[model samples]
Target: MSTPTTVALPTDMELVLKVFPMPKDSNNNGDIFGGWVMAQVDLAGAVLPARYTCGRMATVAVNEFIFKQPVQVGDLLSFYSKVTKIGRTSVQVLVEVFAERRVLGNQYVKVTEATLTYVAIDENGRPRPLPITELQPRRQY
Candidate 1:
């Protein structure tokens, strides 16, 4: 098989999660199931927001999700994420999943890309403000 072309991985995004799928995770077509990949993306996308939320959080929405290529078992999957927006009680993040084939050393395929939004929640599950700003050293102090 001809090697797939690759683009340089994002430098600005954080490499939040790196995982590989097992045989049980494969779909009928033998590719890793879409739902399983989405679940991993959801977990990866939350890495950045967790720093700000500093409390319970919930995934409020998957604003956009696109599977550009199929993933197969044994392919090394790398999830990169960046925070796109930080609201008073919510954060929007962009996640990109790349598949690195063992045969194609140093090459990566853009398998999936998604945008997700998460909300910081209080003990009762109501929206809560991000605790990040409060952690900054006060100028008045």
Candidate 2:
């Protein structure tokens, strides 16, 4: 088996959480499943939406996703998220994943990165305008 890669995200990165991949989450090939990573990314991106919308929300689009390295069991995964844009009912978040190989301590490598768009929603799942915030900058677009 090939050794897992280590990942180090940017210093400016805002991490939501650090998680360890488990063996049960692996695919038949013994690598961590892609869907597992995707779920973590979704959760990471949703953190801001919950606070900004102050209510329900749903993922509308995965604008972009690129996996740079394979994730394996025992890798310590860190999810970092940042807001890139916000509209009337939609919020765009950029998420990056960094993984530290268990065997190779002190080394970190970026494993995946993505842009996700989520829409603020009502309890009924209908889109709703996000609550305006003084901290949020006004955008012409």
Candidate 3:
């Protein structure tokens, strides 16, 4: 048998989510659907942006998305995310999804990577400038 591929998880990014795909998430080819992956990416990608967006935000664009490998049922998926840009009223995030095989000694395989943009919104659903004061300074040791 060939050795399974493994990738080092990112230290700079945050572990936003971890999930296991069910059989229902798979397609005819026995791999999970791309839409399902995109939906998860959207959810995972919003994590870092939420800190800056505060009240509410909406996905405005998927700047880039690439599915590196097929995700099978029962694979443990970990979603890592980081903020790439924080604009006046929007935040761009990079989300990378890695899958671990339960039978393959939990070797990690990068399944997907996506860049998404989210715009802060008001109660009326209109775009609103991000609250700059919300980004408080971190304490220095």
Candidate 4:
């Protein structure tokens, strides 16, 4: 088996979500299902864009997604995201997921990375212009 790649948690990106996978989230192999991870990623990826959109938005595209390591049950997952592009009505973000392995003394492994695009929407579910034209600096929580 290949060794899992250890990585430092991101300093520049905002931490959007933290979750622990339960046994129910695991597949037959005991690793967390990719679709479950993807769903969480989709939710995490929306966070940064929401700040700029300041309104309802929907994922328009998953530009890229890569799984670098498998997520095991009991691992604490942290998702970090940053806005990469701002269009007239869309915001693109890159999200990275890290798993803190308790079995390895809380070592962090980069498990997944994805790029996604979200479009601001009006009440009618049609695309609308973003509220902000440029990213505003904000304090990290």
Model 2 steric clash pairs: 6-108, 6-109, 7-108, 7-109, 8-108, 8-109
Compose the digit string of candidate 4's lDDT tens values, residues 1-141: 359967899998999999998999999999999999999999999998988899999999999999999999999999999999999999999999999998888999999999999999999999999998688887567
Predictions in order: lDDT: 0.88, 0.83, 0.88, 0.94
lDDT winner, 3 or 4: 4
- List all candidate RMSDs to the true structure: 5.0, 5.0, 3.5, 1.2
The full ranking of all candidates by lDDT, starting with the best, is: 4, 1, 3, 2
Cα distance off (Å), candidate 4, residue 97? 0.3
lDDT of 3: 0.88
User: Worst lDDT window (10 residues) for model 2?
Assistant: 132-141
lDDT of 2 by residue, 23-91 (tens): 999999998999999999999999866668878889999999988888888888888888888788988
The CA lDDT at 133 in model 4 is 68
Model 2 segments beyond 4 Å from truth? 1-8, 133-141
lDDT of 4: 0.94
Model 3: which ten-residue window has the lowest total lDDT? 132-141
| TM-scores vs. true structure, each candidate | 0.89, 0.86, 0.90, 0.95
Tens digits of lDDT, candidate 1, 17-131: 9998999999999999999999999999998888789889999999999988888888999999988888899989999999998767757988999999999999999999987
* lDDT per residue (tens digit) for residues 8-100 in model 3: 999977889999999999999999999999999999998778878888999999999998888999999999988888889999989999999
